[model samples]
Target: MQERNVDIAIIGAGSAGLGAWHAARQHTQSLVLIESGAFGTTCARVGCMPSKLLIAAADVAQQARDAEGFGVKVSGVTVNGPAVMERVKRERDRFVGSVISSMSRIEDEDRILGAAHFEDANTLVVGDHTRIHAKRIVIATGSRPTWPDFLNGAGDRLIINDDIFDWDDLPESVVVFGPGVIGLELGQALHHLGVRVRMFGVGGGIGPLGDPDLRKLADQEFNADFPLDPDANVLRVELEGEQVAVTFHCRDSDTEKTERFDYLLAATGRRPNVDRLELKRTGLALDERSIPRFDRLTMQCRFDDGSLAPIFIAGDANQDLPLLHEASDEGRIAGDNAGRYPDIRAGRRRTPLAVVFSDPQIASAGVSYAELKRRDESLASIAVGEVSFEDQGRASVMRQNRGKLRLYAEHGSGILLGAEMFGPRAEHLGHLLAWAIDQRLTVERLLEMPFYHPVVEEGLRTALRDLNVNLRRGPAITERCLECGPGA
Candidate 1:
């Protein structure tokens, strides 16, 4: 076997591993980046970029169909399924190509192409030919889509979110399992593209929402145009001829119904890719998931007695927050710390932010209301401000008035804590709130920021005005200021 020694060894050259490579190089030159798969990020290859391209087509179709309200008579909105998939694939490859080109710049000597496993805490074996001994190791192997074993009954009829991007054309019908981000986005896109879609989930989760109200609202909003049972009482799933059949007891009617679909897209969830690494050989404290117990602040795994183990896990491997930004930040931190061993320090973790590109788009920033419950803090200690887009001026103007935004603040201190929203422009709204949370802005202070009129952001001011009232930190908004425009 070829034996190599390095200062640091990073597994998985996805976003996290790439970030680690760049950051770690600052403190050490004797490091290697390892990958066993394609040289593009999941976001570029299958996660975000390709999905957004599909959604863009879906959005165009939806807009063309829904243009009647503006006195624009639109007819014959033909959806060329194969053409849609063609653009999706073409643009997706463009994005993946860019990422791969950048990755190609890394010296071949610094890049090892193989599946590696732990030979010891300080040693890794790559396939059959190479053994690597490193002073520090960073696990950034990312994750893969996972589902329950029962889903296997669909056999060849089953697919995952990853398969959607590779399709030559949209299918006739699909039954989506797991109404999280993937399910919602893909399901709605397929529906808008004139494909029959029925989404089911084990739990009553609409997306990545922590607030129950937003979840319910999202469920209602999405179900308006398609079938979605967040908590499905599915009785059976099996292959019937070329299709998959799903038998379920409908929650609304309590009647057993059987539906056949071309495919069952499992949007279930993802598992960290540490199982094949043989983590048992690491000699570190491992959680039930077999992941080494690592400090989030420093990304350092601990030995059984709580000493640093010279190993770190980041990105989807750590599974703290699966967002790409989080993975990148964690990888940078872990890499920097691994490059400068025993000089570990806490990394900067930004205010929590998550977004789902489902219709009306879903977003949450900072501490969620659900998190407050987990903290065992009294609900009364926090104040909530609510704004319904159903009557917001700009939302009404755009004919997108079908969501709600809820902002939270410390009751006594008036500090803006977090926000959850299921509404138009939530992607933008989420960023503003995350920035406010990161700045530790109070409700009063946020209100001092300028808000341009006749924009969707005016709705933010409306919510903040209500929040100021709840915190009682400032005078109530004048009754005249209650409405920004017609029916606002």
Candidate 2:
């Protein structure tokens, strides 16, 4: 193989790899990026953008159907599945094209369109032609949807996120096997779009939410839209005549349940795409899950010597935080540190933020209620405050009054530790909470801030007020200013 030398080499052309390339370029120009598949990341191609497009179409149909509650009688509401899918694909391709174009800005010589495997700690062999020797390497190879062993019998009947958006026509009914973020979102969207959708999961939780209360609310709401049987252990899957039959044991009720659908969509989760890399040749030992032990603060891989290597892993490949924003942040950290190498600097960790884009969106930031309850040191000091949107003015006006909002704080310090909510516009509320928690803002300080009238944010204020009461920590700024500061 022809050998090439570079200051840095990045694997994967997805968000994380692109991020690393962008940041690493600041430090060195002698670098290369290797990708095996489409240049666009998962989010643009399948995860976020395309799914949101589908969800938006479903939302329009759902809104039209639900318009009667607002004294607006609407008739003849129907969704064209093929048309919706067409639009989603059209827009999705645009997004993917944009990502590819951005990467195309790099010189053609630096971009290798092939799979790469590690030949040694500092060498990577691409396909059969080129071998790259780099001072530092960043592995942002990303992840792929996993198909369980039980699904082997289904063969061509199995569906996955990678190919879901490419369907010419929507299935009449589908069995979503996994109630994770993707499963829940797509299941609900398909249901709204007139597809009979049922979802089952091996975990008790719905979506990615950790807060039990929020999960319960989401469970209720999502179940109303589609059949969601979580904590279900799928036993076997096979073809029954024309449909796919699934046999699963429901953990909650301790019973076996069988269901049939036109097709089976597996949203079970994803596995890091590292197996083909031949990482063992690089002297890096992988854990049971094939993940390299790395420092979260430094993003450096732990070598066989138990010392840090010049290699870094980020994004979904690391499987630490699978969200796009977190992946991008991790990529930057990995790139910065890998470019700096021996002079690596520690990166700041942001407060955790997770959101599931289902109806009455589910969101959480920082220490969730379940997390605090699990920690002995924090449980006693934990306090929860909530506001129901069932009767909230804005929710009622919008005819979307169906969920709740909650804020968690430390009782003694009254600091906003985390928040979990399932309500209309919870995405925005979740972002607000994430920013405040990142700033270490106290509940009292948050209350002192302005809350606009007749807005969804008022619901947030109400929760904070309740939180303040639970903590018994009043506002830092008094309601009265005592005659306008000096001498007004």
Candidate 3:
């Protein structure tokens, strides 16, 4: 067996792991990265980058179909599903290759192309042969698509999110299970591509975790035309000859119904990839949720003796937040604190921002109103604004005017609490709110800042206008003379 020593070891070369490696390399040269698969896991190859590309193409196809409204009488606008899939694969391959090439450029960086398991507190065994010792270790192993046990035997007819990109031809009809981001995005994309799509889930569309208004808008856009059985749960998948049948149990009624489809795509949630790591040897404690019990701030895993190890956890494995950007930032923070001189503890105040990539994207930042209500009964929050994209000039011009922006503010303090946007350019607008929340900006100050007119950003101005209306009627109103105000 071969042995090596490094200042830090990062497992999983995905977004979070890569970000950690970049941050650690700035401090020391003794950085080692290990991945069971090739560099660039689902995000680079299948998850974020590839999936968004297909969504963009599907958007174009939809827009082309709506060209009649623009006084263009265009016909025979056909969607070549095979061609679109080919382009998606080509683009994904290019991006993945570039990431792999860039990772290879780091000096003295050991890249182990095998699975790694903890041998002890500071030791790792990889590929049944090599042993790696490091001062600090990070577990950033990402997640994989999962299916319920009852639907396991569908065999070749069953497709997960990862397998959809590998399809040579699109199926005539698809029944997608799960109502999360993946299911909604893929269902809409396939529907726009002319595939007869039906979605089934237990909760309402997009689940109960997202914004209600945003979920409503998404349902109007995609679920309105497609059959979305929100109160439906899959019971079994039966394969007969060349056909596959799915049996679903309705939550409203006790009736069981069966439907046949050309393909079944399961977008069920993902679990942490800790099964192969054999974590028992290290004796690191875990929480009731089966996740490693670590300090939320410093991300240091504690031992049975109440001593802390240099090992850290981030991304889906840590279970702080499942968003990609949040995981990347957390990984960077963990690496920075792990490599700190004298090992000073770092305080964690993370404001997670996430965007669900759909036709009308859903993006949110900071705490949700429901979560705040649960935590603090007396927490005062004002829904500063919930305006539609139809009022925005840029959205109308782009012909993507089907969304709303809702901002939350602390009633008394006037501090920006959180923002949820579902419309054109929701991702960009959501980041703007995330910046404001992180900086603790006030509604009045945010409005005072200059924003260009006739742009999509004017939607933010409109939302702030709602806050101004509330502040006018609010008890804390402080009116100043227009002549002597800052405007003078």
Candidate 4:
């Protein structure tokens, strides 16, 4: 067995671990990154990268299908699911290969291909052969798709997000369980590939914390193409020969129904990949959800001894926001704090900016209206304005007019609290709102800022104008005035 010492040892080579490794690399040459599998876990291999490729293909297919409506004569159009899957796999492999080749540039000793478990506060045993002693250790093990016991028997018949990308042939029909971000994104992609996708979940929208209006818009758009059972709760999964059958109960009807599909995908959710690590050996305790207990601010794992241990956690393992961007940000913070002073201070991080990659993409940041109302009774906010795609000339030109933009600002302080956008080019519109919310920009500043006219972003200008007008009218304006007043 070989023993080595390093400044930082990062477990898992996914987004968060990679972020921590890159951040720590700039400060110290002695950094070790360990992974059970190859680099680029779900995000690169299956979650975001491959899924987006499939979505892009679906977009082309949809455009071709809709071209006839715009007086563009189109010949017979056919969707080749296998070909689409092949292209998706090719692109995914290319990206993953690029990442792996990049990792090769680092010293061989710095990268370990094995599972790692903490031996002590600052020591880790890798693959039962190599021992790594570090001043600080970071756990960026990420997460795995969660499937309930009820679906256990389905076994090989059911696929997870990680398994879907490996398939060479696409299923003619897919029943996706759970309405989380993955479910919606993959569901829409599969549907666009001509798969009859029936998404099961009673949850309102894709992401649990996405803006409600955005959720409604997604439901409206996707429901037109695929069956979105919002209140459907899957109770069991059974393998019937070549097909998988799902039995679910509807919340509204309280009746059970069974649906058969060529493939069953469990997008139920993800749990931190901590089970195999045997964390109990190191005296680290897991919460009820099986996630490690850590200080949310510092990303430091809490210990019984008044002193903090060097074992830190980031990304999905911390069970914070599971978005790749948020995880990487947390990893950078954790890696920096781990190597530096013990009590390094930093401001609290607010709710992260999140987006759902769907046809009509959804984006949201800051406190939600429902959450704010729960916390503060007297809390008041002015909805600056909501401009539909129908109102945007760019959307009209592109014939992608199927979304809206909305901004919310504090009633008194005028600081931007949150924003939501749905429809074509919603993701691009979200970036501006994300910057505004992150900077806590005032409505006055936002209104004064120059935005290109005749663009989708100009919708923000329309929204800000509405907010300015409402500010001029006192606080006593009724909901009717807010909706359809002379100025409105």
- The alpha-carbon lDDT assigned to residue 193 of candidate 1 equals 94
Best by lDDT: 1
Model 2 stretches astray by more than 4 angstroms: 233-235, 248-258, 472-488
Q: State which candidate, 2 or 4, has the greater TM-score.
A: 2
Model 3 C-alpha lDDT per residue in residues 210-323, reported as the tens digit of each score: 566676666666655687776576777888666678888754588998878888888878888876787777788877766678877776787767778788887777777777
C-alpha lDDT of residue 217 in model 3: 68
TM-scores of all models?
0.98, 0.94, 0.89, 0.89
Q: Report clash pairs, candidate 1.
A: none
Clashing pairs in 2: none
Best by TM-score: 1
Off by over 4 Å in 4: 208-213, 233-236, 248-257, 284-286, 341-351, 377-384, 470-488
Model 1 whole-model lDDT (C-alpha atoms) = 0.90
lDDT of 4 at 450: 69
Q: On TM-score, who's better, 1 or 4?
A: 1
TM-score ranking, best first: 1, 2, 3, 4
Error of 4 at 34 (Å): 1.4
| Residue-pair clashes, model 4 | 4
**Every model: Cα RMSD to truth:** 1.3, 4.1, 4.2, 3.9
lDDT tens digits, residue span 1-488, model 4: 99999888999888888878887777778888898987765677877899888889888988888898789988967888778879989999998887777777678878898988877777889997899998888899998888767766575778888778887877789888787788988888888878889987754655544456666776677778788877667777888888888888864687998888888788888888888776776676567876678877878876655466677889998778788888888788787776674645452565557777887777776666556667665544454556777656667767877877766777777778877776777677677787788888877777668655457766666677666555534443223223422212
Cα-based lDDT for every prediction = 0.90, 0.85, 0.77, 0.76
Give the 10-residue window scoring lowest on summed lDDT in candidate 2. 479-488
